[model samples]
Target chain A: MNSSANSTMPIANRTVFFVSDGTGITAETFGHSVLTQFDMKFKQVRLPFIDTLDKAHEAVRKINEAFEKEGARPIVFSTLVKTDLAKVIFASKGMHMDLIQTFVSPLEQELGVKSTHTIGRSHNVADTEEYKNRIEAINFSLAHDDGQSDKNLSTADVILVGVSRSGKTPTSLYLAMQYGIKAANYPLIPEDFERGKLPSCLPAYKHKLFGLSILPERLSEIRNERRPGSKYASLENCRYEVNEAEALMRKEGIRWLSSTAKSIEEISTTILQEIKADVRIY
Target chain B: MNSSANSTMPIANRTVFFVSDGTGITAETFGHSVLTQFDMKFKQVRLPFIDTLDKAHEAVRKINEAFEKEGARPIVFSTLVKTDLAKVIFASKGMHMDLIQTFVSPLEQELGVKSTHTIGRSHNVADTEEYKNRIEAINFSLAHDDGQSDKNLSTADVILVGVSRSGKTPTSLYLAMQYGIKAANYPLIPEDFERGKLPSCLPAYKHKLFGLSILPERLSEIRNERRPGSKYASLENCRYEVNEAEALMRKEGIRWLSSTAKSIEEISTTILQEIKADVRIY
Candidate 1:
């Protein structure tokens, strides 16, 4: 599947280019946000590692070809840092949106310092210490995932508690991957519901607990795919599990949210915002 | 750990805010890209879900407070869509960068259509079919991870083959989560090396195979942490395994890259680029 094109959606009517000097992931993210405001289908293309002048000319030719074939100017979103490369691409047949230079020049004026204007530094891949720590965080999240190990539970920055398929696993992984957060998760199982108590391992980590609940209908639909016609997939069972989970979280005074219609990014960002200390909520 | 601050880095002398009426992910991505060009430190903060005028006022207050405390204008990167909220935030003490409206208005003019300007549409969570497909891809990646299954080998969009801890699992998962690609990964263990051929199941899907190799030194370091003093962690074993795996991949005529120092994001992006069809290379 193309990253920007949905399979079930209509065929793309236009071409969009994410041109960057390095990985181009940041360019893609910026383009997606602005392009999402319009209700048009896009066939996205990425031109990465376009650092040299030769690569820049090649990129322009590609853009022109896309424009000529589509019978419309391809919309180009570029994060090219070098002045020469940007100069070449800006004059292509495509409509250019300079995502970097527009903001960077103004900020340079504000800070009274020139930007380095170097390529491949967008996310700082050269900082080995920071890189090592990021990998460590990912390893930690994997180790503590799905309540697999409680050995280092005390060191977790956050603990996610919820019923199965309530978005705990994916959310935990995203937290670690995107933000370098150390997250652990535990499922609220049938035994815990029957006992009407939190899991045994969670009492000592009450302050780190965050809960995720889901609508019973959505939970049932998700379970049905995994277990088919089993009792675990029944609506009644889903309702009981969701209600018990919510009640347990409430009794335990854990902060919670419903993940029924939310994206994993949404859930992770909200968790970070709510847990954000030092910022006063007016 | 804070999302933007490394643990051992210096104290932040600047305040940075990522504010959006919906999730602030787009704002954060854009901010990080631009801020990375400078030599400075930032105390990063996020203010999300500022849809209402009341919440907009609260966000402005927080920005102003940060500016006063830091004794400089806090750098605010905002993706708010509402005109009124944008006006309110633009007047705050912080130097605001309107990420949404900067290019959105130009695109609206170019397309000859008014933008929807709706809240919570940045990544399109409302499209439930797309959402379900994304979740399905993630589940598919997890199921096929680490040679865990061969049931759906033919269905994958890409198959990542690498030695253990050569960065296959995380790269596979990132490919799935970030781009909705169905990825399966397999490890090239001693048994496969001794056989002197590709894995039995992979022969049928040769067109879909991509390889990841690593430096023997780094591989040894990673394994030592997992099993201290074991033969598996010895430098000689790592050297032999890496050389044998690379030789096998070369003999099979498969394209491969080193994963020794590359980030998971970099590896996934390169995979997509190499696999991308229809775009001309000039």
Candidate 2:
């Protein structure tokens, strides 16, 4: 924790570019992960869809301009697939980390094979079946959101049960979007608490159920923002509902996690891990 | 494209670990991106919340077991912040790539400073304000989905106007989740097409509006899956709706993109870039 002593040093501003042939999500995400380990602040720009030579040359110009303006070499993290485009960006006066080039050769040696070297396959609808599944999963998650449908619980890969506003909807959506999992979330309302069990439609599909719990104070705070000064937003009511929901889930042998301290990514990952769901898309 | 010749090679199956002290999202995403460059298949496992020495030791054991079982060293991509925990994982019998250690010192030297070396900062709810905004954005997007409400279009950061299933809902959710942008999606239905305009409430917020279009065949196919043999799912109807919608949007000076071939990530990124929206989350 004493690392804060370094704060006395002046912060340096650096220009960084995430250039890619497709959406640039992989480049930006991987580059940002590397950048987070550094203390220096970055003014980052994304240049996606640089699939053509003209676009690649334009990106090189932009990087060189940044280097000239800053009097320091910029850092370029690129995942361009074409050799010509990659060479164009690498020629810029910057520290270019060609992600695909860095690992593809080693992989070829290990696997005794060559890569496709095609652009946009990582984030494109190149596989028709996978694309259809992703869209179907998204539609399924949306249809099943918030106990809106009881017709397809049996078909869901996982069902997220939780109190209202306990991070169920976003987590379900994220699971669908990233992993192509058919995730359905049902809110635990007062009626479920009064019944001392889950909704009637959920028991048959209990194995697919995962529970989410949030801290009472946090739940109260979140609910207050939506409906201030309402009884539903009361701390006492939140505590009661959460306590009852947890007990019900525990009694039914359902696994649960606290959503208060976690992000949507964390919550969804935990659920996927616990359920041993097949990750259709990485 | 000739890379398919590599398919003749025997695929190597290796165990891969994406270990992190926080959500492991960065580790997984970055690792997956790297792994995609190779033709080898991987059995990937995620070990999140390895913030403690005990958890790190357990991770080491699991990694060693995978190595023993596979008769080859596993590949570990770790983003651990604590030095002690990172050292333990690095000592394992795998090709450990210490993501944080590999870059932190270089950054420290370049900036004439030190990093915070903080745990969980990358994917944690450490910033209460940011977390609150993300949740608020999710709520806003959900409430405004599918022309559900016109209550606060003026406050929205982006309003996506598109025909049904033109990749509106998922893109709106993604913008909300990843960037904390209040994205509202209004589906342009037959009524709007008949009227030759957008929704009545959208004109005042023209600057906030973005449009999505899709290939009529693709739209017809997607609709057919939902409502088979109906007018809404007819190719002629789809073509009419898409053509008219695009014409109306063009007349109104609304920028639009075809969603048929683009991934949700690409569509959302394009919109964000066009609007110059500040990406709040990395």
Which numbered prediction scores highest in DockQ against the true structure? 1
TM for every model, in the order presented, reads: 0.94, 0.90
True contacts kept of each: 0.32, 0.28
Question: Once superposed on the true structure, which residue ranges of model 2 sit more than 4 Å away at CA?
Answer: A1-12, A38-41, A126-128, A278-282, B1-11, B91-93, B278-282
Candidate 1 structure quality by residue, lDDT tens digits, B21-52: 88787887888788767666677778888889
Instruction: Please report the TM-score between candidate 1 and the true structure.
Output: 0.94
Q: lDDT of candidate 2?
A: 0.79
Model 2 steric clash pairs: none
**lDDT tens readout by residue for model 2, A113-191:** 6776778656665234655666688889999999999986788999999999898998898888777789999999999
All models, DockQ values?
0.39, 0.36
- What is residue A120's positional error in candidate 2, in angstroms? 2.6
